[model samples]
Target: MPMAANEIEALIREGIPDAEVEITDLAGDGDHYAARVTAESFRGMPRVKQHQAVYAALGERMGGVLHALQLTTAAPAKE
Candidate 1:
């Protein structure tokens, strides 16, 4: 089964409590999604590493239940 947006957000938040996550259903099928995750914890980390963090948050569901996630990650902008 495809993953729900809230489930995805919750998983990411569980891993990075400080993250501000925005999830969009890209295809309206509940399978394809786009996630923009902003967190202070991502600071100083490379883009790949940041993505890895979010992936780790999702655990084993990445390629099985939660497939086709277009993820974008960034550190929060300074005010």
Candidate 2:
């Protein structure tokens, strides 16, 4: 079974409490998704670690139900 966009978004928010998450069904197939996650905590975090965090949130689903994910993460603008 493939994961839902809301499910993915919720998982990301759960992992990063204050994150602003946007989940998109890139292929309309539930299997392929694109996620944009922005949070203050990610301010100085490395990109790889940020991606890892999102993956960790999805947990075992990464390679299983959740097949492909194109992820983008960033901190809120300094302003």
Candidate 3:
């Protein structure tokens, strides 16, 4: 089964409590998605690390329930 957008958002939020996440289905199918996440936890982290963090949030779902994710991560914008 494919993961739901809310489920993906919840996972990211679990990992980064302050995350602002937007998930969109890239294809009509639920297996592919694009997620843009802004979180304080990403501050000073490298792009690869930021992506890794988001992936970790999904646990083992990366290659299973979630087939593909196009992820964009950013630190919270400075006020």
Give the better candidate number (2 or 3) by TM-score.
2
Give the distance in Å from residue 73's predicted Cα in candidate 3 to where it truly belongs: 0.4
RMSD values for the candidates in order, in angstroms, are 0.5, 0.7, 0.8
User: TM-score of every model?
Assistant: 0.97, 0.96, 0.94
Off by over 4 Å in 2: none
- Minimal lDDT window, size 10, model 1: 59-68
Q: What is the lDDT of residue 46 in candidate 1?
A: 100
Query: How do the residues 1-79 of candidate 3 rate in per-residue lDDT, one tens digit apiece?
Result: 8888999999999987889999999997999999999988889999999999998989999989899999999998898
Off by over 4 Å in 3: none
Residue range 1-79, candidate 2, lDDT tens digits: 8899999999889999999998889999999998999999898899999999889998999989999999999999988
Off by over 4 Å in 1: none
Q: Judged by TM-score relative to the true structure, which candidate is superior, 1 or 2? A: 1
lDDT of each: 0.97, 0.92, 0.92
Q: How close is candidate 1 to the true structure, as a TM-score?
A: 0.97
